[model samples]
Target: MSENPHDQPETLEHPEEALHRRAIRSFVMRAGRMTDAQKRGIDHGWPRFGLSLEQGLLDLDQVFGRQAPRTLEIGFGMGHSLLEMAQVAPDQDFIGVEVHRPGVGSLLNGVLNAGIDNLRVFDCDAIEVLNRCIPDGSLDRVLLFFPDPWHKKKHNKRRIVQLGFAEALRQKLKVGGVFHMATDWQPYAEHMLEVMSAAPGYRNLAEGGGFVPRPEERPVTKFERRGERLGHGVWDLKFARSE
Candidate 1:
């Protein structure tokens, strides 16, 4: 007797394929897990402090007591670099976007512990925040350090250096604003160069074919340390929004 189609187990798609689909959905649909408590805390925990898309363009003068150029750091893993930057540059406002719950919580705890008041965070998709919330040409600098490379050949499309996202970032940054990105994955780094090079209204800031060394303001994060121990090469790419 032939095995019934209904009785046969379905061969699931490859995990990488599934992850890529999920990533695309996460970007397009803006659907990600956040518990009610997390939502409430994100909404009301800092009261007059934290920002969200619903609140609209933040009044920087009112929030920080003086208008300052704003810098955005996407996926600030454990906030090590972000916190360090905030401390180093008190005159510039830093907004960090991260999806990891524990990381966000840890950053918030660190902020309270350090009594740092020049930083704010949003625990959601950076694209969503950039598209619906932040005003155009509002950011002075944008940093993306060591984003997941999706190293597999079949999963390269899942990487964040696509044209659409780069264009979106270009629009969000002010004229002459800097867009800095770093990654340890060479292929992803090359992919980033290709995408950003093709992106309109932006120009590469590097003097040579490669990017400059990491800025002194940024501190190495735990992830970077681990990657360094594992002998992964790191690359940094910087682009400026053109007039």
Candidate 2:
């Protein structure tokens, strides 16, 4: 019997390849040179606190060596705010993901100097780390602070707060876990609000379904301070997983 075209099953594209095509990274890596201190930080601190995608799905309890509230911060620039948060909240375990080598180095150095054991780091694409390393529904909180706004109108599509990203974050979060995001760009904030508002399995933590006051727990960043001097208003949004 002759084979019919309809009888042949459609060849499916690899899911990871499909994801790679669909995901437009929001940040551009700048040619920022690392200082000697930063280099040393990477060398010395990596063994103690660094993580890799090749680790596969992590057991949060095993990684931290304790059962504590876990907070994952997507981009900890220079490491100061995240370090401060870790210092203040010793009861909580923090996992920071930063692709910028200099920033990662700085954070690692800070972590070593601070002697804080409640924190760890991943120097890779946050999305990949989330997808391949972090176990689903294992997080207590997820933070996205001052992510690349992709401010230009033509580049807004590259912003990371799209519906797909929100859903991915939701999967990593435990039920009732909160995804807190802060942005200095107003349009990007609105974009985040729109996507997160419509995203399933989330409930806006804002009382009336809009921006919320910046919580005290979130330390103000240097970028935020500079934006403040330029009269840029910061928007903070918190959405909790309902299921």
Candidate 3:
């Protein structure tokens, strides 16, 4: 999708203006209701592994009692979809990375409440978790559903489907591994398609649109529900690692 032109960050012509813009942007970004302490606790609560900044590569055999195929879900908003996937695919290990505090708490609570054992959590940036923590070609699947579209033009650079990011993911995924992504924003979906198409070493799994629905495995999340209510279009893209 073409970026929104008006959403671009203002370019300051003077040094003082640049400083002022930086301060204003920082303050505005942190203006949400979440407290600094809460954010800090979430940021530091998770331990880092050598591969990904967000996750550690401890012995997975210890956690699941046997090494199992691993799938990653990035930005699990409230854990509903992650929980459902875990339930449906009990044999596959799922790792979820999220930075939202309440969402992390809710995911933990849900995992405990539902007695789920095949999942792990990391409450931080997924990029750090994937690049620094996850071993190359170790993951069987990756899921990114309903990520922030950063709809404004200036912020489009912050969107996650850049060439470098896709290349990193390609490295982490095993040959024939699956990468699934969904978005309710049409422009963002198109942008994702363009980005992924340009990335080497991967192939689209679905010819026309993408993979068919594994509805039994991937339940709709609350965010998707709200998007549906708002008459927004949802797009799903699936790709596989190509040798």
Candidate 4:
């Protein structure tokens, strides 16, 4: 008897390729309403500060106009916090990846308006960008703040902080580089901790165990403040790549 087509042995993906595949994403695409300012931001400011998804590995030094500590942020909503981080740390180069067009435009506009020379924006998905553009061991730190919690039990797997994700992120960070994440949901925090702990080449920065105090480097955003007002607890997890 011939074997059914579905019964054929499946080819396994390389570990690296499997690391980037997401059957379920933590966030839904929401470009939202693009105000005139945001439209203008992409139209005018992009020529100066925006990076195309099609562009491959960047020359970090040339992009920032100097060799500096490089930080990459994923899903920077509205771009306010990213702008703040870039503004406060003038010596560091900041690269933001956000899929939302309105948010991308907002950040680009803010970068132009603030006269910030140390920032760049990627209007694209982070996983693909990281795989294509970011070179291994080139980043100083990676920031992922307030990623969608995907609260339902069945939806939890859609969360981005999986063990494979930790590994992929680790490859991008230099030795001793940091990956800092914050979430207002408790269960997701626990989930994040479990994944990060199992992933090798990283040491938790939260002395001894559990969660850590929110680092000062992550300035509070309007959304966080609003969540606080609603009595939502926040969790911060920081891990550094092993030397």
Q: Candidate 2 has what TM-score?
A: 0.90
In order of appearance, the predictions have TM-scores of 0.80, 0.90, 0.76, 0.92
lDDT for predicted candidate 4 compared with the true structure? 0.83
Runs in model 1 lying further than 4 Å from the true structure: 1-45
Error of model 3, residue 199, in angstroms: 0.3
Q: Alpha carbon lDDT of residue 38, candidate 4? A: 88
Candidate 2: count the clashes. Answer: 0
Best by lDDT: 2
Per residue, candidate 1 scores C-alpha lDDT tens digits across 1-243 of 221223211112332232122225222222346555445444454453456777666665676777899999988876778888888887889888887765665566667666778888887777667766677778899999888887777556656667667776777789999999998888889988987887777888888756768776667877778989999878889999996
Candidate numbers, best TM-score first, in rank order: 4, 2, 1, 3
lDDT of each: 0.72, 0.84, 0.68, 0.83
- The per-residue C-alpha lDDT of model 4 at residue 143 equals 94
lDDT for position 172 in model 3: 78
Single out the weakest 10-residue window by summed lDDT for candidate 3.
Answer: 22-31
Query: Per-residue lDDT of 1-243 in model 2, one digit per residue for the tens?
Result: 221223211112332432244335656665579998899889999998999988999998999999999999998888899999999999999999987899999998888888889999998778788878988889999999988887767666677777667777777899999999999888889988998898889999999999999899999888889999999999999999999
The total number of steric clashes, by the backbone 3 Å criterion, in model 4 comes to 0
Order candidates by lDDT, high to low: 2, 4, 1, 3
lDDT of 3 by residue, 164-207 (tens): 56777787799999888888888898888887887778898876
